[model samples]
Target: MAGIELRKVVKNFGKTQVIEGISQSVPDGTFLVIVGPSGCGKSTVLRLIAGLEEVTSGEIFIGERDVARLEPKDRDVAMVFQNYALYPHMSVRENICYGLKVRGLPKAEQERRLALAADMLGLSEYLDRSPRQLSGGQRQRVAMGRAIVREAAVFLFDEPLSNLDASLRNQMRVELRRLHERLGTTSIYVTHDQVEAMTLAQRIMVMNQGHVEQYGTPDELYLSPATVFTARFIGSPNMNMLRASLERGRLKLPGGTFLPPIPATDAAFTGRAGEILLGVRPEDLLPAGENAPETLRCRVELVEVLGADTLVHCALPNEAEGQEPIIARLEGSSRPGPGDVIHLGIRHGKAHLFDPVTKKRLAV
Candidate 1:
């Protein structure tokens, strides 16, 4: 196994750029995920690493070797694609060893690899069954089995679980994590699903419009997003962004709402007094308890009961007419119906501030 590196890598499709000067590194034996919405160049990055797509400029290295110009077969990396890409007539055992056979490897080595992969993938009993005879998840395992036999220096997965049903996808996520742990191989996985990225990645690189948005551990991205796009994109229910400004040495918000001034220790809000975006996650808005410091009056818009907690979507009192509804994740099953007025206390310390013009986080 080997670490991977991308230095100022760029990809262009004739006139338009798809991956723009992106650079990142994956340490040996680490699992890194490239994640974002569609057309974000995630899949393109995977292809570039797999040597399937040519870089218009820059370099890609697998350990000490620059593989930017190498053929896919020469990269010493195995890729499991979104589509199963299985040969329908081939039995599981045959499919698993096909790559090795094509490479003219000896029969003894091929059988040894095939047995190990089949057992690891729990396909031992189904090894003689054709691809058409297996289930979706089974076929995916076969695809992985094929990659495993190669014993490549690196593994690349391009939304490999995208075709599976929700339950099966969830199951596969666990299985994939276990497989990576046992192999300790440097792996690069690309997916649009944030949930998959959060659950499986050792580190995540969030991309947008050909640009690298942020790259860090899942907790780092979730707790301290580097930009508004990441703040909204990473978390469930999304973080709420509200218009804010400095007024009379206090923080002013839409709907004539006023809160305590930004902390004097927060240098980011100093020497700047214009439009900024205040970001607060749903879970940070708590139901008013005893002696709540800062509270907002809101009318419930909707409620989502999730057994352990209830998601209350509410709109602020008269002052916040046109703003998006605020969501609060409160403990227990106290469901509030539409039109019900509730007071929510703001956990201001947990909130974030971003520069509206740049849409970037303003560190305090």
Candidate 2:
């Protein structure tokens, strides 16, 4: 197992800065996932670690050694790409053992490593099959097996499951977690999918517009996002943000409804009034009665029913023209339908307040 570190890492394409002043550490044997929307430079970060892309400035380190100038082969890290770049003509065994052979390992040693990898990945039953003969998930396992036999110091995965079907992706997620646990290798994973990031990583690094937005455990990013960008990006169905004001320790929403005072702390935005936002997770808000003092009456814009939960899209009265609507997840069954007038209550204490100017969470 190895710990990887990137210090002030920067990458550029011509005049465009793709990765900007990024720094983070991966603890030994820890699985670190870099996640963001497309074009957010998440894949660029993985490629930089894998030595596939040259850094414009800054350093990449493997364990205690600075490898900024090292070649991909010399970095002692294996990368599994989004596409399982398997050679169709090569047998599964050949694909897994190719690197070991090129490295001039003894016949017995290569065979041992190949055998162990195939067995672990349940590929022992298909050793002689070519890439064309295997399923997507099987091909992915071969790609993983190729990396496994390397016994590299670090592993870099670049959306390795993007090509699989939903069910296969889920299956591979479980398999990947088990493999990481068994090998205990330091791994850096990059993906745009938040589900993969939340399920696989010890900590998640959220990126946007070539900058690191927030770095934290999944729960930290979900429960206490560092910025508005993160609060809206990390959650499934997304969190709802409503414009509000703070006046004399009370929340003042649109239409002049005053809510109870939020907890006061240095983290809270004390004096901030206009240009403030109240953020609530979809799972936090609930339907309320008309007499509910803290409730905000919204017209149900849409409803999406999943097996265990239902999402209700709501529009606040006086919402800015052309502004994106808000969404709330109702636990279990939701009796409300489209065009229904519903009262949605802000989850007290659990809700977050942020400064619209700085986009920082108010400590309350």
Candidate 3:
């Protein structure tokens, strides 16, 4: 396996800059995920690493070699694209062994690798089937098998599971994790789905508007987001943001009261006082009737039941116009339906405060 590095990477189309100076390293045998919204240069970054696109001004390194000027084949990397790019005329076994054949491996060696990959991926049962006769998930597995047999230094996946159904996607996710554990090849996966990134990635690089917004482990990005943008992006149902102001060592909002200065945040806000953004995750808020000393008076607006949990949408008396409504996730067993008047409590220690001007988290 090889470690990959990109230093000051930049990409452009005509006069428009699509990827601004980006620099990151993927450690040997690490699974790093590049995630962002559409048009955010995620795929472009993958292509840059694969040597499919020339860098505008930066260095691309695989292990100790500079491959910026090398061809894709010379980089010793395998890429699996979103659409299963299988040769329709070739059988599954033929498709898996195509790369070995091109590289002039002996016929016996090709057969051995093809058989091993097919068996590992459960494609051994359908080795004689053509690509056109396989299911979407099966075709995706074939594409992966092609990459696996290469035993390349690194693997690049470009949303390979995007075309599958929900159940199939989940199944493939588990399978991919197992495969990565077994091979331990350095991998860089690009996707727009936060769920996929959270489940599969050891570290996630969140991109936005040609730049990286944040890069961290899933828990770090979710629990202590460095910016307001990150707090909303990494969670389900998103995070609830409220306009707040510091008063008497406490945070005062329209419909509720918050904890005093966070033990870790006293230094950052020392002598500073003005508008601040309060961020709280959906799971951090609970039904108020439990009688927590600190509570918020809000009107229940709607309810959405999702298996084991229910999401509560509420309208706070202090809610700013045009701002999204607050959302709370509660146990499905205890959650009330729509229009249920209830008191809600905010988890004090779990609150996150951000500077309204810079959008940076208060150093708590």
Candidate 4:
């Protein structure tokens, strides 16, 4: 398997630019996920790498050779598309071996690779079945098997599991992860789903308006997002961003809640003051007892019970206008209903700081 690299790649359709000048070097056998909102150019980047779409400017490399001008077949990259691009007339076996047949590989070599791919994909018994007879997941596996038999230098997946049901999507995620573990192929997956990006990617490249917002491990993106967009986009239940600023020695929220300076947390903005932000995760806000330190008094607006835990949707005292209720994850047994007043304490050293002007996280 060979790594893929994009050097200042740019793609434009007339006056509308899709991919901006983006550069990244993915190491050999790395699982890199490109994720962003729809129309953010995530899929275009994947297509460019697959040689399905020509780059408007700059270069693309597979291993050591530049393949920007090469045809799709010569790039040695197999792409699994979103729509399950399978031949309806071909049986599973024929579909899997189509690439080998076109390349005029020997019958013996074709059978060997087909068998291995089928067995690995758990499709051995369904080889005689047509695409119409297979389930969505099975058809996806067949598409994957076709790519597998190619034994290409890189594997490109363009939202390959988007057609499956939620349960099947989860199931296929596990299967795909296992497939990567077994093959160790250099793979690039494009998807708008952050969960898929978080779970499958070794390094996630979060794209925004065709620019790279952040590129790092899941933990880095989650705990230390580069920008406010990354902070809001990467986490589940979404991080609560309160409009606040550095006061005499603390952070003051719109609700007039003042959080004392935790040296490490405040060092990044010691002298700076104007408008700043405090990013609080749901789990970081705890249901505190009376007289608890570093706690903000809030009135519960709603409660959502989710078996083991309950989500407390509440509004803090002196909250700013147009502020959405912040959610705090508490134990299922600790139910705080609407209108119930409670104190929510912030976990020490857990809050994130961001600049209001640049909308980027403050490095501490």
Candidate 5:
């Protein structure tokens, strides 16, 4: 296994800059994930690391060697692509062993590696089957087997599970985690799916518009996002943003409701007060009693009953025109019908303060 490092790496195509000075490090045997929206240059970062694309500037290191100009084959890495990239005409055994053949390994050694990979991937029974004869999941296993036989120091996966069905994707995610644990290889996975990033990554780098937005563990990004974009992107159902103003240790909402000073000792309230964006997760907003303090009276617009939870969509009276309705995720048993008037309160210390101008999280 080997650690990988990027020193202000940049990639440009003609006049367009796709990667903008990205620098990060992946410790040996760590599973890192690059996640973002489509066209966020996540795949480009992966290709740069795999030596599939030349860096326009800066340097890349694998272990202690500078591999910025190395050829793809010279880099000690294996890539599993989204399309599987299998030769349809060859049987699973031949396809998996093809790399070994090209490397000129002894026939006995090739057979040994093939056996080990096949057994590990549960593909021993499908060795003689052609790519056309196997299911999509089985074919993907064949591609993984091909990479495994190489015994590369790093593994690069370019949305390898995006083509599978939801059930198969979940199953493959579990399998991939297990495989990584057993082999302990340094792996970098790129995807637009935050769920995949959260589940598979030891450290996640959230990218946006060819730039690194935030880099940290899943919990860190989810609980204490560094920016408004990250707070909205990393969580399910998205975080609810309300335009408000802070003055005299109190926050005034759009509809003229004032919340009590939040944690008198919070750094954000020391001397900073102005137009701010308040972020509250869907799960953090709860139904309030009739006489509860600092509550917002809302009219329910819709209610969706999920298996274990219910999502209540509501609109605040005299709210800013054209703003999206606030959604609250509550237990399935708490049912509030459309047109019903309800009051909601922000859970203590669960609210996030952000600078409206910079969109950065305020220190609390």
Candidate 6:
């Protein structure tokens, strides 16, 4: 296993800068995921690390060695592409052992590695089958087995599960995690799926427009997002952002709703008393009891009944024209239909504050 580090890495195509000076470290044996939307340069970053693309500037280190200019073979890394790059003419055994043969390993050693990889991946029974005879998941396992036989120091996966169906993808995700635990190889997975990033990564680096937006553990990014972009991106159902004002330690929302006053000792509100952005997660907004203080009176516009839970989409009374309804995730038992008037309250200390101008979290 090897730790990987990038120091101000930059990549550009012609005059278009795709990677904007990204720098981060992946600890040895760590599962690090780079997640972002399309055109965010996530794949480019992975390719750069694989030595498929040269860096425009900066340095890359693997196991304390500078490999910025090294070829892919010399980088001591194994890559699993999205499409399983298996040879159609070869059986599973031949495909898995082909790399060893190219490197001129003894036949017995090649067999040993192939047996180990096949057993680890549960592909031992299909050794004689060609790629056409295997299911998508099994074929992917074959590709992974090919990489595993190399015993490379680092593993790079570029959206390796995107091609599978939903159920199969989930199954592969568990398999991948288990494989990592067994091999303890430093792995870098690139994907545009936030769900995959949250479940698989020890650390997640969120990128936007070719720049690093946030880098931290899943809990940190979910519970304490440092920027508005991250707050909106990392969560399912997306965080509901509202334009609001803060004055004299109190928060004022649209339609004249007022939240409880902020204590003077709270560092996040210290010296802040103007227009700000309020972020409330769907799960953090709940139905208020009768006569509850600090609640917003809204008219339900739609309701989605998900198993074990309900999503109430509501519009604030007297809200600005064309404003999107805020959704509250509630227990399935609480059924509120369209056109029903209800009051919702933010959970205690669950609200997130952001500077409207800078789009950054507000705190000391």
Give per-residue lDDT, candidate 3, residue 225: 89
How well is each residue in 1-364 modelled by candidate 5, as lDDT tens digits? 7999999999998999999999999999999999999999999999999999999998999999889999988889999999999998999999999988988999999999999999999999999999999999999999999999999999999999999999999999999999999999999999889999999999999999999999999999998899999999998889998888887778888788898668842555867678999999999998899888789778899999997999999987656684447999998999999999888999888888888989998877
Each prediction's TM-score versus the true structure: 0.95, 0.96, 0.95, 0.97, 0.97, 0.96
Clashing pairs in 6: none
Q: Which prediction has the highest lDDT against the true structure?
A: 5
Candidate 3 per-residue lDDT, tens place, 1-364, comes to 8999888898998899999999888789998888888999999999999988988888999999988889999999998989989988999988888888889999998888888888889999989999999999999999999999999999999999999999999999999999999999999999999999999998888988888888888888888988888788888889999888876567777655665456566666777776889898989987766565557666678988897998889877765563347888999887676776667777757889998889888877
How far residue 176's Cα lies from its native spot in candidate 2, in Å, is 0.4
Error of 6 at 316 (Å): 2.2
Candidate 6 residue 85 C-alpha distance from true site, Å: 1.6
Which window of ten consecutive residues has the lowest lDDT sum in model 4? 316-325
lDDT of 6 by residue, 129-175 (tens): 99999999999999999999999999999999999999999999999
Per-candidate local distance difference test: 0.89, 0.87, 0.86, 0.89, 0.92, 0.91
Candidate 5: list runs displaced more than 4 Å. 318-324
Off by over 4 Å in 4: 319-324
Q: Report, for all candidates in order, the number of backbone clashes.
A: 1, 5, 2, 0, 0, 0
Q: Write the per-residue lDDT of candidate 2 for residues 105-176, one digit (tens) a residue.
A: 999999899889999999999999898999999999999999999999999899999999999999999999
User: Regarding TM-score, does 3 or 4 come out ahead?
Assistant: 4
The residue-by-residue lDDT of candidate 4 on 1-364, one tens digit each, is: 7988899999998999988999999999999999889989999999999888999998999999999999999999998989889999999999999999999999999999999999999999999999999999999999999999999999999999889999999999999999999999999999999999999999999999999999999899998888988988887788888778778758877777677676785566667777887888888898778786667788899899998989999986555574546889888899977999999888888888888889887877
Better of 2 and 4 by lDDT: 4
Candidate 1, lDDT over the whole model: 0.89
Candidate 1 C-alpha lDDT tens digits along 1-364: 8999999999999999999999888899999999999999999999999999999999999999999999999999998989988987889888899999999999999999998998999999999999999999999999999999999999999999999999999999999999999999899999999999999999999999999999999999998999999999998889988887765446677766676555742565556677778888999887885455456667898888898989999887434456557889988767878889887766757778888999988875
Better of 2 and 3 by lDDT: 2
In candidate 3, what residue range of length 10 has the lowest lDDT sum? 316-325
